[model samples]
Target: MSDSPHQMTPPPPEDEVSGWLRDRRGHFDQLVSSVEDYAIFMMSREGIILDWNRGAERLKGYTAPEIVGRHFSVFYSDEDRQSKFPDKELEIASAEGRFTVEGWRYRKDGTQFWASVTITAIRSESSAVEGFLKITRDLTEHRATDEMLRRSEERFRLLLESVQDYAIFMLDPEGHVMSWNNGARRIKLYEENEIVGRHFSIFYPPEAISIGMPGSLLAKALKDGRVEDEGWRVRKDGTRFWGNVVLTALHDSKGELRGFAKITRDLSDRQQVEHLRETGRRKDAFLATLAHELRNPLAPMLPGVDLLLHAPHDVATVTGIASMLKRQVDQMAHLIDDLLDMSRITAGKIALRHTVLPVREVVDTAVEASNPLIREFGHRLTLNLQDELMIEADPYRISQIISNLLSNAAKYTPPEGEIALTVSEKPGPMLEIRVTDNGIGIPKALQHSVFELFDQGASGSSGGLGIGLTLVRTLVEMHGGSIALFSAGEGQGCEFTVRLPVITTSAPAATGETPVIPSAPRSGPARILIADDGRNAADILGLFFQMEGMETAVAYDGEEAVKIAANFEPDFAFLDLGMPKLDGYEAARRIRRMYPRVILAALSGWGAEDDRRRSAEAGFDVHLLKPAKPDDLREVLRQHG
Candidate 1:
């Protein structure tokens, strides 16, 4: 293999190079003239048209022979020509090497359209300005599209600004406020100047801001395209209001992060209205419960009074009727007392009478009170008492709390179920009482609300006012104790634990139980007035009073009672609280004015503390719930006579 030297060719001569350049210019001209999108042409340094291509003919609507030597200024509108814009374009291109702009251009037919033009000044070998190469593109359609887009954006901006209920605004990709609208000002209580450029977290609560919630929301929106949330938001004045917000991420055609669009609505007023409606529903439920509880005691009293009146000679029957009446009266009083106690508890008007007592004593009293129910349900009671375990608490309320819990367990549990009450002293000077039952357990969803008033569980088939647990919790808390309930869902049974702080003190002296007093003997025939809206209630009660050695006069309404009392000159008057024409309060005031010494009493279904206070204010000596017992009446008469 012989290594031979590479040979190099010599450069072309000047004459051959000039010929090649000329051929290339011809080819470039042909290519430019073939294009139809842009008008390619040439203008002399004097602003005269030198050459025109097919594109120029198509764009300017002129043939080569008709427009070749014409002034290039003819392509401009008359006003542009008058302003010498065409001449100025040449001067700028000559001085700066090129001039490019978009402006109006004229066609051969006297019509005008938008165009983009570029003029490049050609220079000779001597650096002298030669002809100019001008290229123009008809941009009329593009201009029309741009105008439509501009109008659309204007309309969108106006729509957002006009909204009053929604805070429509914009934020940067970094969660900074960008633009504010009228609705934003109205809802957020900040002016555009004050809010723009600030972090969007300003609208969030302090707690939410501290947790970087606003930034998290922005990131979520960017990932998910949109995010919606409802929560508390702060206004410019620092007042809190509920807000419903939607955040939508904005992006460009290239998928570049632009910003976000945030729309917020103030829902505080709507939330308040919904709350009030819920309260109204609870009130309606309570009223229905009140009606049901009242009728329970009244149902049995009706026939007991009838038997006593129609069979007075049957001592055995009379005694049975008297006992039944007494039991029913006590039941009614208990129902009324529960209602009043709940009211006082809710109003924070109840006071606890604290005393040192052994927990065994409280447990014994509660077990005694609940023994009947336990036996009725056939439940086996188990007691785990720590001997001498003591606490300083309200003895009566504590006993009531324990009794209610035991009673609840008995009622909810099936027959032959087991109930255990355990009392123990825990550390920290705390006394714990746990009541457990193998009963129908509360549902998981309702366990949290079991202590709420009027909340009834699925096991509430046994009749109750639904306030037992409410009272239990209220009384336990009043004694500086806490109560908690646990259940393993439905049918898994339940356990309630109560913990109270214990104190070191000597146990109080135990008082003797008061003896039940016997009913007094009816002295002599005494006049009485009875007023009630319910005819059955008034007639039955009047018959019993008449049988008890009292002259009874009946009236169905307050007005009738007042008229009857004036004529009868009754020594005692009973007025119903709710009656037509006149109410019990007014009737009592009028009757007391007429007969200053009459022992006035109120008879009504309502037995709230306020009812009693109103009765006293209206001159009633005593307030009695409806279906009053004959023995209670005889006792009152015995005292007055």
Candidate 2:
């Protein structure tokens, strides 16, 4: 291929080049004129204004025809112009390529404004200085904002130092004290200079410092962003005070851990001591009364045993003694049950088992349980119930509530007294149950405390354990309901109204009663095992089952029960939860591994929901409280069958 000479393109004529340059300059001028925020113009090397745009005209309060050709010194302050500072700015920009400054400048009207100005030398290709391009921007609003923020910071510092209650301070990332307010000095009895370099652990007790509590707390706050604690804090005087402290982690804008901000409040001992004393007084009174009540039950039991020993052959005399003892035992059991319920309520350990139940069924159960006591007192009982009312409640607790009120009335009322129970619907999604008794009414002064724990208001000999009303109110509230007392006077009658939220007015499913299981022992697992730490309890239960024609074996502890299960492999096992030698839960787990299908029951005196949950976790099918009624035990067996 033949090589071709490189094609050469001729440059445009000077006239055409001048036209293109003019076009670009016109575009630049248009662009600079539209800018409103900045004053832009061209100035001579001598600091005289050579060109002006719309922005410069707007900023300087002069049109292009009026301000052009004027020296840029007009924008400077009088003192600056007198000092030749305007000329100095151009000279510096020409030598250094650019110069920038922020100061006060004047408009054509002679008003002053804060401004930021930059002057840049327009240089040729050989770097020779030409005219300068100046840009001026208004900064008045920004300066005002910065000044206001500075004043605000000063006020906040004063306020923090003036606070007298809370001890506010700052710490470095290493937990060394950095800043202290006046409140910190007052509360800790230490001057700022004395504590600024000290570790925050100085405020904690010696024991806390020995265990690295302060360092650990700082780490926790750093991790969790904030932490609150209350404990004894030491003062410089060596006295200790209970302080509630809050430590908040401070962070920078980049989310980096900066330090900590701490606030402490002194909860002085006087108020706490008074509260504790009142609590102790109530507890002491309850213990004394409990001792007396238990003694009353045991006192008659000893005499009854003597009577039984003397009248060994007389059936009538023995029956009377047995019945008397049974009543006393029942009374003691009732007292204990109430105490347990109250404990559960106060500890927030009780979880209600709610069911959609008809109010009539609950009322009927309560009335039946209370009839014997009512008949013994020769009291007239009346009931007024609305039909087809349903509620969501723990059925047992609901009945217990009514039974307690009824028993209280029977115990306090004179013979042949009248008691009334009325259940009616209300306007809202609520229903009301009222129990009234023509008994010694509550005194006016004591009405407010009638439902408090261990309250002795208007409670004479017939108060029972003095916690029935408290239990009633707690149970009612748990059902999302409320209870109130109404009394005319001491001589008149008293009424307790319990209002409960209703689930529905009528529903077929709710109206249907719970399935009835026979209380008599029925066909179930033939081979059974019973284990307990109490030999008498275990043997008696075994004997009772054997009498009912079931093969039964008894063990005194958990280890023996597991050994028996290894060979005997009973179809049903009732294990006392508090057994020695490995305990019931472990025994149940081992037995379950051997016979996964075997039914396990936890028999114990402690019947909290947590206990039941633990039993369930250990593979027990049921948890029965101590002194399990014959009827309850039979129902358990029937389910298995």
Candidate 3:
């Protein structure tokens, strides 16, 4: 050992270390000064700016000499300076070793820019705070883009909340409901707490769920980006509604499934409107057929009447002609009655006269009414009656319903076919009437729709107005009963079953006496006025009243009727609703003001419930449809009399 401790080549002097650090600092300064995108500067521990780079000078529009020794708070906005944010930032940086924030800053020219800033504390070897290294970047454009995106999202959310017609919602990847909007609540009748986190399939009907339609729709949306469908959906209350649905698949930037956006609109009203349009078209067709049907009977009646008028007065010849005329007239009347019944049913104007009646009587009446047609078709008929069965029903309408079914069977069945009508009592206090025929049957497609208006079976070759079954269904429903039809297909026999609630009460007392309508006393010849737009109709009606021992006046228009009534002071007036020159409504009002005691009656082709309401409002006591039978007019006269 040459000398004392083997000295490591005397440790580098402290001066040398200091020189090396200074050189590194110079290099860092050069590196930072060269950058133009970010402003780099130095601040004293007191928040006073000391050094500024080229980037800082360019961004703040201040030269190094102009900014040096200035307070760094000059770069902050006035509000931030008032709040002492610059000092707080420096204090926080010194204590925590660093502070970063983004906010508004001012340039030398007083202009503003959004800025991202970072302040890092410098420390001495003794761990004492020395100064701060500050880095800032102008981010006005990025801030603007972010603000625009935030506002756009807010607008979309508001739009979804405000919508009332369409249900807009989101679903998770597995079809769980994620979000629901106001419209979703309105349409689907579900609150967010009740629906969210549940499966989206809750909106599907049982039939749709059975077929996995909700999952299928999701899959289709995922595969095709979007899917649209129109079908029936169930509400929270389990009532079904027609819905127009659209499902759109959502994806991340990588094209992976994120979820789905579902939009649903209730289309029940639109569907109803379309149904009405379809019904109108069918009604037009039915009307055309009705014209032909009316002509069919009228054609024969005209020739037969001509023959009777010109032929010899032989007893056999007169009797045969009279029978033929009666048959044709009866046929025409039957057709007209059916048309009127359908109209009344559609207008909700048919009032049922309900009573407890024996089922046997109902069956017998229907059978008797249908006998002529059954014989004409040569069908073998069978009847099985449960004599103990009684139902609270509109006896006439019940008989009509059964007669319609029987007639339908006779018309569809081939000659010599077999038909059976059976009555049975079920345990639910219900009575069932089944009518079956070995005839050309309804197609399977039509079985469900056979009760709809103008829905004729495929095998319905026998011409008809196609309203009989509709009327039957309506009448059955009015009695709180239901009717169902079953058929395998065309050429297979069909069965129609009707079920009605049974009444436990005894049958009503029967009275063979007919009702006698009391007529007005003929103090003198009763004065009457007839108003109609149809000249011939007015004259003929007037003549009929005259023949019935009444003084009558005829007017061609409502205005003329009012004028005539001003002088005639008639005891009764029949006003047509659709006469030219001031309609019957106005005419009646005027006549009522002048002669309040006159018995007013409305005679018009318009026979709807609304029509009757208008007539009553116009002071009419009676409303009769056009082509009123003589007996109906006589009955009205008798009541008023």
- On lDDT, the candidate that comes out on top is 3
lDDT of each: 0.82, 0.82, 0.83
Against the correct fold, how does model 3 do in TM-score? 0.59
Backbone steric clashes in candidate 1, count: 0
The worst-scoring run of ten residues by lDDT in candidate 1 lies at 1-10
After TM-score superposition, the amount by which residue 150's alpha carbon in candidate 2 deviates from its true location, in angstroms, is 38
Model 1 agreement with the true structure over 533-632: per-residue lDDT tens digits: 8998889878988888788999999999999988888788878889999998999889988888788888876665677778899988878866675667
What are the root-mean-square deviations of the candidates from the true structure over C-alphas? 10.7, 20.3, 11.1
**Distance (Å) between predicted and true CA of 361, model 2?**
1.4
Q: Write the per-residue lDDT of candidate 3 for residues 1-641, one digit (tens) a residue.
A: 01112110121233333333333445456567657788887666677665667778889888776776678999887888899989999999999999999989999999999999999987777777767789999999999999999999999999999999999999999999999999999988999999999999999988889999999999999999999999999899989889999999999999889999999999999999998998898778777878888888888788887887888687788789878876676677778788888878867888876677787888889999899889998999999887887777788888999999999999999999999998888777788889999899877766867787876667542657888899998888888889999988888988999988755567665655555332244568879999999998899899999989999999999999999999998888988889899888899999989887788889877666677888998899889877766777898788776
- Model 2 worst lDDT window (10 residues): 1-10
Model 2 score (lDDT): 0.82
In candidate 3, the residue pairs with backbone N, CA or C atoms under 3 Å apart (3 or more residues apart, or in different chains) clash, namely 520-641
Backbone atom clashes (below 3 Å) for every candidate: 0, 0, 1
TM-score of each: 0.55, 0.55, 0.59
